[model samples]
Target: MDDQTLRRAVNATLMPGFQGPDLPAWLAAELAEGLGSVCLFSTNIVDGDQLRSLTDAIHATNPAALVATDEEGGDVTRLHHRAGSPYPSMAFLGHLDDEAVTEQVGWGIGNGLRAAGIDLNLAPVADVNSNPRNPVIGVRSFGADAGLVGRHVAAYTRGLQAAGAAACAKHFPGHGDTATDSHLALPTIGVDAATLAGRELAPFRAAVDAGTLAVMTSHILVPAIDPDLPATLSAPVLSLLRGQLGFAGAIVSDALDMAGASGGGRGIPEAAVMALAAGCDLLCIGTDNTAGQLAGIREHVLAAVRDGRLPEDRLLDAAARVGDLARAVAALPRNDRSPGSHVPDPRAESRPEGTPHLSPAGFWLGDPVHPLTAPVFLRLSSTANIAAGDTAWGVADHLAGELADRLPGSTCVDAADLTELAGVLDAAAGRPLVVQGRDLARVPFLVDATAMVLQRRPDALVVELGWPELPGAIGIATYGSGRGAATCLIRLLAEGSR
Candidate 1:
């Protein structure tokens, strides 16, 4: 009956890596005490062998530790931190437009991650890219078309689940159509009921129908549902995802470290308590911060229970949901549908009873197209031209540096002086042009320059790295114009061209 133990069981963490096969004693201690999950990020991952060792060590301590990663397999990835994601983003897949192919891509991503000791993939972004100015979720989304995105969501969910890693359909209710990044500031979406039912909620409905095991909440404000609170700390919005959408899966929160959920001026510990009270089963403590940050969260959540801010039964319900998810991901059988109905099967997860499968070294993506490799993901430079630019001259230079990280020895240019930029475009000639920066719709220079380049190469891949998207590019979005995004986009472009 101790909330102390219960609180420990509900937190999912991003831990720093250790020297070798063994993790730090502190992490081992956290795992032993029933930490619900271990999240993998770029910092925590080095390569396949080291990551497997890390996960294996954690599993030894906690059988159901739920090893997961943000391996969306495109711009936003953890596995391909050092190299790059060999697979396509949801935007790329959506362009491919074949449901079976989308499922195949999802399976490939899951298969690769599972091979590296991941049991859950926080991927296949279910949000629709309905807004060009959405800074956080442009290329991460499948597409602007709701029905099409819904199809991909179900397909990707089914594929990942089939590949033995549970799929987490994310930003529940939808993070689409927002201008602000929750990481920096809270965003508000003021769509009416009809718009939500038609656009925002469609993909989630498909995800639930596809039997997704988990749904992560957005930190944005949806005045239509809950005006006063951000969705992560909003009981009404979560209830909508539960009662209305019929999602029986575990509901997790976006990282509590984000400014949106940090209670404006409040500490993260208080935010964690509110999130749990709002029906989040798993509280994601971002790995960017240390485990020390979680100590206060654990203590405060327990205090919330003792002081009646959070009901004891609600905490139990959350813990139960987390346990259910852990069991489900580990592929153990549960007789009851309720949370915590399944007891810990030490042997069940000890050996990781995954369906006999290999991490697909090379796999087919859209259509009967080319097979993709795991590491040296891209190698295409027929014209020796991968031109890149930014709206501002300074960012253009910075963008060029990042592009080189992915595309070696490619030409880089800043868009200034239409005549000079046009001359540069002429120099690129038949090569693929890569543009990085804000949404294309808002920036007149980019719009004009992109139009000029399209006259030369109609299929140039325009990417917005961690910012708004450009609408009319061959590929609508890639999360950020970093190494991961560039690698994926270049690969996609190479395959499509061939």
Candidate 2:
């Protein structure tokens, strides 16, 4: 098999889409050229009807061609129609602390996707968000606990498969530990192989053991495994994923266009060649650059195989796997409808925004609350008057600003101004004194100071900003940023019936 033959074979399994000044013509051209598959992004996907028609048209072009998307039921959903399914994300489910609820969310997501003519869900992110500073994948994951995330991934896979759709556990080795975005640049993992085996690889292993249909490789570098190449282009990582973890499913490469995988040094075709050489079965290129960019790879892949740069046997093997997956999906029982029929979620009832919703208030956060903004508001305004000791910094000033605006007549006292605060408390003896952003673990003296303040005013309202179970305050957990709306709600609480 020469480069041309391998190029032809490689062209046979692409899940490609197109973009240009004129997209419809681009779509037609890609189809006529015998491109293998289509992936739907936010732009390519419109409503359910439009998506169904688009998928139908693509299938009509090549009856055996595969169509795919990344509709993971949260912010990543493609068909976010008003009539579409409503499934909460991993963050919400993780907060619920019920495995049963997690499984049900998976089932709803899978059924909804299947109804929408999408056979693949590039979902169930197996990455554990170990680094709090990670810009992406924060609450998108289950939680910081790897074991909990693994269990949820296994459950999600089962629920999705039960509904006749395939689930792909993503960022194969792990992407949660990295602080940098792979879309911008390559992130290197310094943890030893043993540490990876313990923390990073746990969820992936669980996913593989649960018989997930596909595993999408990450672009991050794991020096302990393959120092030079990222996992998506590393035979060692893919082999470990398949051989050691016993993952017999299809291995899909993350988008070749991402800088972590392709952009900085290599061209798309060259990266595609390297990826295929590294043992990936399916190549997923976004619509933005698939047509002209990969045009070179189509021919180069064929040439590589012919000249022994790529193995002909590997090409055939990969193609067979892709075909088998398609056949498996096809052989499953079909759902014939008006091409856009789906059952609605029974529990989806409208609740007016700003209504007081029951939620768990605590010092520590394990999972994100549903209707996330509501609980956030409740916590932020739960207390009335604001007070602080001397030595308060910018964080204290920020809290003071929030209090002065949100809670009218709220007084902010510096530690140097503690005497003034005591006088004011004496004036309104039983009114609540709100203490914000106290890190007693770092400054232990603050513990005694806070106790002294509380002792004088037993009616004081103390909001612990940092950890769980603050010794002398009501704990409000703001798991991440962008919780300002929640702060407003808590401020409203402080003004009431005092």
Candidate 3:
């Protein structure tokens, strides 16, 4: 292929989203123009059968274009709300303290994705949860312990690959200790090289050794390496993963729409250019990106290649890596298109890299599976849908006692009345403030309330009710506002403090 065509092919390597159950016409036009990939979200998912057809539509346009989704399978399954996933969050697997369990969870989740024609899973977050105040990667991570996360990272990678879906250990060079969510703002990893090498990079090391075929880069900044650019756009940072970690597979950038990528005066299109220049094989425009936005990214990257702003050789190499991933996905040994056909043998087929051989009884660890693991996979809490502030307040009051009983010196409040809430927030300013609510991004009043509280008390934490990303807050998101979720939060707070 010519440089311009290859440029369009490589540059169009975006995982953009569309509305409804199938591929919209606008996106199909762009995909025909050499768009590299498509990513599915909950909005895009109807069921496993529906997902297979959706990816088939993309395949019709470009057969080898990787159909990917963030089926993290625990708290962040893209297909679960519509169909369902058997796996829980990594925290549950981590808490289980069994690498064999983590591998089974991966196989179960991977089997679901394979049935749906989603070949690439941009998941098994390599981030270690080194900082509990991290806005994004809390329960999504295995745990705060370095060794535990590393062990499961290898296991998750092994299991997913064993189930015939390519595993991508993600947020590389680590997103574990940042206080910011890259979706909203650039998060700086403040640790030194030694600290990062020991804590954050441990799981990535394990993942690479476990033979993961792809690695996704984080948008967070690391001053220990390149102080200016985030890892997504930093050659040195990507080099560390490639050179020091010896990851010889596909390297992907986090979403270009993120503040960590587009923040600091860089636009999404330009960020895509920089990402390809920096060594990312795939430039993700994010699940929320539109057809026009994806087209623009393709156009700009092509211009960069033509004008020599991005070297042709570099783009060619990255494009080859991407093609490699597509080929890898194409080569998986599934018998049929049926999602359930690849149901992995938990004890025999989908074991982790270093996990010891186990008997069939160990599949459920000598207990029934569903009853034992339901708490980890199930939704934990719900925010009262009462639009009235006072009614929500009453609900919070009812739940506050349940949360308070779990941990001393902890309480919950509905951010309904600012004047009244401000007084309560002021009183608790000295201690850790944990605030959780639903649709936090949509509720301007709630967002403002949290921001105000954080302004006065810069140490306050905000947990989301599984909605859009919350900005400018240093806290963990439990993906729910229920009692069980609150207990998880309380446990995080208690463990973090000690």
In lDDT terms, which candidate is top? 3
Reference-based lDDT, each prediction: 0.65, 0.60, 0.67
TM-score, structure 2 vs. true: 0.69
Q: Can you give the TM-score per candidate against the true fold?
A: 0.74, 0.69, 0.71
TM-score of 3: 0.71
Candidate 3 residue-wise lDDT, 1-498, digit = tens? 475666566644566766678788887877776777787777787766887889888888888788887877545667654322334567656755777667866776677677678888988988887665555776577877889999998988877877788999989998888777887788899999999888988899999999888999998889999999999999999998989898899998887877889987889989988998999988777666676677677778888988889988888888778888888877766432221222333423422222222222211111111111101111113333211001111114444443454444444444456786676776665555556554455455666766676678664445553322534452444443322233334434443422
Give the CA lDDT, 0 to 100, for residue 491 in model 2. Answer: 39
Q: What's model 1's overall lDDT? A: 0.65
Relative to the unseen true structure, what is the C-alpha lDDT of residue 68 in candidate 3, on a scale of 0 to 100? Answer: 84
Alpha-carbon runs more than 4 Å astray in model 3? 1-4, 82-85, 334-498
lDDT tens string, model 1, 217-304?
Answer: 8889999988898999999889988898988878878877778888478778888889888988887766554457656677787788
| Candidate 1 pairs with clashing backbones | 465-480, 465-481
lDDT of 2 by residue, 421-497 (tens): 45555654444454443233223444554565568865444444322233334433322111221232243344332
Cα deviation in Å at residue 288, candidate 3? 3.2
